[model samples]
Target: MTGPLDIHTARRRYITVCVLFWLPLGLSIAPLILLFTERGMALAAIAGFFAAHSLTASALELPTGGLSDVLGRRAVLAAAGLLNLVALTLVGLGSAPWLLGLGMALMGAGRALSSGPAEAWYVDTVQEHSGLDAELRTGLARGSSATSAALATGTLLGGALPWLLGLGPDLGALVSEATSELVLPLSVPILLGAAVEIAFVAYVLTALRERPRPAATLRDVLRGIPATIVGGLRLGGRDALVRRVFLSAGATGSALAAVELLTPGRAAALTGASESGAVLFAALACAGFVCAGIGSHLAPLTARLANSGERAVMVSLGASASGLLLLGATAAFAGVASLVLATIGYGLIYLGLGAAGPSENDLLHRRVSRSGRATALSVQSLAQQLVGALTGLIIGVLPSGPAPWLLGGSMLLAGTFLWIRRSGPASPTEAATPQPHTASSSPSAVGSGPLQQHADQ
Candidate 1:
């Protein structure tokens, strides 16, 4: 990592990191619920497991982000990978309720630690090589695309592995017998994911080079993080554009929560059995990831087409909202047409979010300086995660059917509207946003007179 790399090399490394980290999560998705059930866990217990994951991630988001800022990207990322390695292995092998729960909480901690470090590292590297006005959209978008592609590929493979093993003399049964029922067919994906985590950690340690931060004592590291955290917290309040971006992140979260909660049951209903429903859902999930990858790949073009990052976000989010609305509008129907529309709606949800993410982040990166970059990204993630959790709760309590879809769509629409008024001084003719003053402090120091002028303009 000490060796100098061109921006192309940096971006390629970043994309690879994205794929390596995200693919494992994707692999676990297809078999996770079934695995829990196979272990004799009820719906409530399964929900508790997920709640543990979310709660742990939510609680650690800021601290972990600050950890990255205070420590360095490579170390934090490697730690995250190691945590995920242990977490996935434990989840794969452990049968007891507490073991599984602890595994999930560890997984969440891994997730929180992994969130923004790689991207932050890339951004930092680009600035070092290309100066202050480095082009970040392409790298960010490519990273998003790589992540989506990994998920899609992993979904297909993970979903197929168990079935493939089940056929031809039932290798899965043989494995179960050999392992004394400790490792089921469904557990293979997770075990494979754990192996991948090892690779992810190794790659991150070697590929994501960073200039080492000054070696600080534990107390100094501790003190610096809070100051950075406080600065990141104050960031959105001071910068109007940053605030809009965070709000938009929340809206995206709400929409995503609705989609994730509603889609599985809806698929189950359509297929008339949980097993078939799962297959259909896996296929749909894969397709959604593909669509998301395509959207991320096209994000730069989307910005150009819409004229500005602001407009692109609006258009992308609006498209997503419309998709949700379509789902809501067709909720009462029962036909192939309804199914097709629902499928399209699902794809659009991922696609729009994919496209919107890069554009919104492009706007965000311009305003925040180097110091609090990861912290800012973590805050953005926190906003999304916390809001998504709340949204899930709200959707759960609400009566089923179009109500959930409508709630999400309405919230996304409101977020879209935030961009319509153009709170920042983005030009109608240009796609890139104006950069902020690079004051060498945290984000609280980032938005002073210059950023105020940006809002006014």
Candidate 2:
């Protein structure tokens, strides 16, 4: 009999869950910023909140990821959704810094708990139906598209809602009404998000079925951690291609984070617009999301056109670097035309990056063993976070106008380096063909042909 965890069903569920999860996150950003401003919080304090949350989340990621290996993906993800519901609720209600910090920490924990497991679940489920190669690109594309759509919708609503509510207030009552309006509109998504998450948890409980975990002691689980970490590191270290992929991913992530941190300020300066300029920039950001969503949906075609996964990634990175360069130029020159061109460039680059995401992820999965997958992924995640944090700190301390130029230049250099290092000419083993999928076959029966062929040579 065909398994319940078919790729088509799983993909739909994955997209649904992503939309629900991201809507709240998207909505929360504006409120979080407003709250920070309202309280007269320092940049350092805001940075501290993010840093503390990331540090704690990083600590838990590995352990919980391992737990997913032992306990199963569905259980872990359901728990994560519930945790996010609580955390988002707290964030909406919080007025004090300590309370906000607590909420942020909880949010981080929820993110940590959810991050690797959902992907793992998708891959595992899809592989059961269609095998890895068939599902990998399409699955990632669908998920990315869903996430981008969620962000665009949430941001548009978040940016517009305050103004909509602020319109009706009488002159004497306007200030109080506006403040109250601000809180509710921003908080609405989070409340709705909680309900969506609960629904997702229920869906997962009913829909997802996987192989039961093998009997193991708590000691057994703990003992696997060291070996798992060592195995992941060894696999990446020994393989030049894998090492380059990690480096490229880390660099790209760092560059993207730097852009996100600096872009709004740059846009405001270039346009000579006040804080209200943020709304326009926010709209631009939503446009970028739409671009990314479209690009991800068309990733398969892009990958084919590029000839190889490595080349696709290079194209993506190169586009992003170019976009950043344009952004820097626009900021320096300060013209409306330049601003429009820069936004267009940035959106296109984001699209390319989204296109490359799935292929890169598939390459990682192909190279690593199932037992070490989450650990390997966690290492990559940690590297990206570390690099992003460092980039943010450096930008903050230096405070140079040319910082965007430097960051863009660095991304270009990194992408060029990876392109040069491309695992030249796949061996006969490396070029092994993927197997076709059929609905009647079990996952294990579907295809070991390609992987086995690759391993043999």
Candidate 3:
């Protein structure tokens, strides 16, 4: 963590960080809403809880990304882990609504803090040894695969733990009694997530080694962060390729929003009962993550087959859009064929998104130098989150049919078309050390962020 590492060492550490950082979040996913319901929160309150988390993360994304650029990746990541630790503990143990809400906000803050630093650290490490010529797709792909694997594994474990405990002499009751009704069975996964967060912090501190930035005063950070943010905002305008990446992220967010919004009720309808539907949805969710992991693992081959990173993004996203269209086309049907097609479409959606991610990021990395890497990533994240939220709002009001699915697919398809031609940089890395534009050429765009560690982002 303190010295220069070889590329192999760096890749290994990057993969480890991905797994450790994501596993705890995965653990909480299956049971978080369930835990809230167990604690007497109504659907409205639970929705409010999530909104608080989303808003907090969104608001903090750009600033936190700047913080990482100004501070160091390791420091910001460690701080994120610490915040998650406290957040998880509060969420698991607190009975009061306000305490739970505060916990969620803190978790959002932690998410914002952690977003881009880990990957930025990996890119920096590789670039240190190999300079601008490093083959980053492999590392990024593997890290992404590890993340999906951790999520799939954690989802299974989180969902099963409570049931397993219940089957063995009422262990859950005993724990609740011991804690005076505070530690419910549903709380177990979140508490375990808190424990895992400890490991995440330790690993981040010990494994994600980065060359330190120069020590600076508070004044420097205040000045540096805003200036860095401004420069990052200009990144998209100055670099057309990076703009494509940002817009593509928004398209992805839109498509994902549609699927997430529609999938649950579809599952329930298929199963004919909410309980069975919940079980089926969980299974499908786990399967989707596995498919995404497989796609990530195959990203290198995907790039090779498509002949270029840009082409690979086009192919991958096109496939994803096609899947959305399939869903939309079959929305009015109900039969074995419909079910089979729907399942295939679901798998394709995740797989294509997963495959496209590494290639897209490889392009982004090549365009930006170290000075504003994390901030660039934050800008991408913000676009995705903001656009996805907007898409979700629109989807919410639409009548149940293929319209929503078509709308999402069309948006993604439009984004895919943006890659039909090169984005007009004579050289891809022309902006590797980019600067903000002068007054004569002023141009704008990014907001304040997660397709991050979760599919839900």
Candidate 4:
């Protein structure tokens, strides 16, 4: 507290926080849909469960950000971890539809609670430690890369653990009298996830600290949160650039939902067996995550090469859409060739998303003040969740394969056009230049002038 925060320290903590929070999520993903089916839930019901999770997360997103801002990021994040611990436990044990849905709702709440607080803490700490004009791109990019690596690693582990368990002792037979036959294998990854959530809580409690806010009090915090939420809501309505970014977030979310919802099944069809499909999907998922990490690491270079963040986003989104189109086009093919194309397409989709994320967030940070930063991020998340939910419902009704991918790809392609109509704030490189600060009475006053000087650059 006495010394200024070093950039390296800030960056390390940011990446660590991201890994801790997202790793459990990644672990659960590989087994989640299959687990539900193993428990005998119908397709429609499974879709409902996913929709419930998304709606819960979307509804709570803005309010939880307010909670983070008012109650302090550490406390809110700790609570989120605790909730996730409980949720993962319930999910691991519960076999009934209602119970599973309840677990999902709790998981959504935890997700909403955890979404933006850690990143907000990182930025606030960095700005406090190293002045407002300090370099942020490299640190942010590293954090994104760390998250993708965690997902890639976790997905592979989660997928392999169950099969590995089956290969070992008959743990399921021991519990067969107490639970369903498939319970033991399906529960392993989620139980491991619950354990990780415990670690996440402990880390948040011990590692993160809030900067002193001399003027902040219980009454002021309660009053300010609502005002902050309103300001966040106004961001999209009032700012053309922010609105365009929000639209893109929605479109990208849909594309992601398509891949996540459809790809495992597609992978299974390629192998013609559930067990083998699961294994193949796991390998593909891991590879996809690696590609994501590579893309995230390349974001800054991509932006510089394109001469602007907006241009970088378009390039990335175009690549993503093209990948999805490749997926759709190759749907009719069978055997190793189809599998190869699908894998490449899936990897490219994640690559684009991973590359676009840091650039998008960097621009967003320049547009909003610290007071509303978390809330703005929450809004961005809300857009994704809302669209993701819609995408799930649409995909559920649509004929399997190709059709959903085509729709998702079309939406992503449309998202790219949003940038053409509006110019956003200056690119990250331009914002990294030194600038003077001005004192203002407004709580939302932040050093963003240099951040917005794209016209001159």
Q: Which candidate wins on TM-score?
A: 3
Better of 1 and 4 by TM-score: 1
In Å, residue 80's CA in model 1 sits off its true spot by 0.6
Residue pair clashes in candidate 1: none
TM-score preference between candidates 3 and 4, better one? 3
108-163 per-residue lDDT for model 3 (tens digits): 99989988998989998998888777899999999989999999988998899888
Write candidate 4's Cα lDDT for 123-237 as tens digits: 7788778766656666777888898888887888888787776665766556554564535676788888899988888988877866754355666566656665666676687
lDDT of 4: 0.75
How high is the CA lDDT of each candidate model? 0.82, 0.63, 0.83, 0.75
| TM-score for all models, in order of appearance | 0.93, 0.84, 0.94, 0.86
Q: Which digits, one per residue and each the tens of the lDDT, describe model 2 over residues 1-457?
A: 2464667778887787777767767766555665555556688878777776788777776666655655567787888878878877766656677876877788888777776666666766776576545547777778878888888887777666655655665331453466654445445545555667777678768766766655656566565555445444455566666676667666766666767777777667655784755765787778878887887787777778988777776776677667766666665565568768877667766776677666677666665444445555666666666676677777777655766556744764575467655665334223222222232121101111111000000
**Reference-based lDDT, residue 208, model 1:** 83
Please give the clash total of every predicted structure, in order: 0, 0, 0, 0
Candidate 2, residue 32: Cα displacement in angstroms equals 1.5
Global Cα lDDT for candidate 1: 0.82
Best model number under lDDT? 3
Superposed by TM-score, candidate 4 places the C-alpha of residue 155 at a distance from the truth, in angstroms, of: 1.4
Model 3 clash count equals: 0
